[model samples]
Target: MILQDFIAINEKGIYCLYGDFYLDPKEPVATAVISHAHADHAVSGNRDVYCTEATSAFMQLRYGKNAALTFHILGWQQQINIGGVEVSFLPAGHMLGSAMVLMVYQGVRYLYTGDFKLQPDATCEPIQFCQADVLITESTFADPNTAHPDAGLEIKKLADIDINIMLGAYGLGKSQRLIQLINQHVPDKTILVPHKIWPLNAIYEKFGYQLGNYQIYSRKLMKEQRQFVYIVPPFTFDSYIRATGVKRLFASGWKNLQVNDKDTLYISDHADWNDILKAIEQVSPKEAWTLHGDGNALKQHFDGKLPVKIMN
Candidate 1:
């Protein structure tokens, strides 16, 4: 039987039948091995949750302090035996505590990469490559035309701005990364963020990331019409700051973002088509399975090179 048969994509998520564990299960399950703390990837109410130390903390913060779930902290390179399978975690370089899971069953190695990027991010651990027999990966930005510029170069676009810039970002990973990037690249600029981002920022700093001086956005402060960089969740951009007249900038990898009078910075945390192919080449997987986003690009790219399956 093929190694791919051991791991199947069910409605719940990618399930490892032999090991009796789920990788980043979308719904609550008996045993869940989470890759990161992103809402789509990590959820609460699982009987058992397996993830890195940082991911565990993120889960607590996201699910609330009193979340009733069994936690298992799996450090990088720490291997454990579960249901007759050997499993371990590796750095994914996507966010503060992102990870790539490796499972070995019956001498065949299978690597499941949660969301990941090849670029450097001082905010989190770097991506680590390893050999695997079968590789299951995310294809968020897997189009051949998609290419991300250097993170520092992308963040530097805000340095020359003179007006108070209203930056829209996801409150979890992107907000923290942007804060650190601005601090490192444009230190002179004062940064302001919505109250919602405060707790996540505290967690990032608690994990030893040094984000520069930033204050919570106040209506009084916004009333002053001061020239400062203000970051807020994308969803709140319209209602929260409706009356405030500020230059808008969005930091994301999507090429064709439709925002009125706003500049889109192509900064992404997922690997593009070339990088996806490169990662697969590095892993040298005999078979590949693609998930997340539109997996067509990966499937077409590996059409004849190796057997590829698009996981539903």
Candidate 2:
């Protein structure tokens, strides 16, 4: 069997080998399979791309009509035969339309997990046990020693405060999650967002996520409400939310980074150490290959347990 990573970063854009596999280095790949709608994972380019219908709609807002048909809309668990390779989409639980690619050929199966969380989330389907001879998972928060508080409890602790609470998270799945958690718990106050993330909010809205009464911050809005919840990108702290008197709370898998003075909470879209171990055990491959992260760490954890190989 032969394996290779076709994705590489360059000056202009990414050279994609699989997702939007295209020939011309100057143009986007001719056939791309998007994992999700995140800008980092899915971006518009000059060619045919394939993704879930929800993802195509999200791309349409970004690239206009050009993104709609350029994509082959697939549903979750749908199987397709591309060339001689067999591929299927599985729920990754990162966000709406997020997927893990399962490829089978020559009697071996490979599952490429694109930012998945095992816990049931608001935005997408629950993560399930997938059978793959080779599993490729992310290590965004791979440390075994790191632990996070219960999501519900931690969210309540922040919202219980009587001050204006601005939660720092990514505009995609994280922000919507915060909104849902806060609104259901602390219904009196409204949810909020940064100005730029409003469009992403609209995209979420298209999928029937009803986020009510969220607006970008303003002195007028602040003066009226003594207590509210605001969701903004973590980078917004540097410029937008730094000056405000509001209390800051950061949510990410990497609370260990100590990047902010605000209260830190570890909530992530990737599997924790235990999740990784369990996934590996469940797959129980005769030979295991790890990639898209530090392979040695995963190896060390599974040491003496399985046949492991380092994969790029």
Candidate 2 lDDT at 220 equals 72
Cα lDDT, all candidates? 0.84, 0.67
Best by TM-score: 1
lDDT of 2 at 25: 29
Query: Which digits, one per residue and each the tens of the lDDT, describe model 2 over residues 242-297?
Result: 55678777777775533465566667777777777776776665556654466677
Clashes by residue pair, model 1: none
Q: What's the CA RMSD of model 2 in angstroms?
A: 3.6
Q: Lowest summed lDDT over 10 consecutive residues: which window, candidate 2?
A: 18-27
What C-alpha lDDT, on a 0 to 100 scale, does residue 68 get in candidate 2?
Answer: 34
Error of 2 at 96 (Å): 0.7
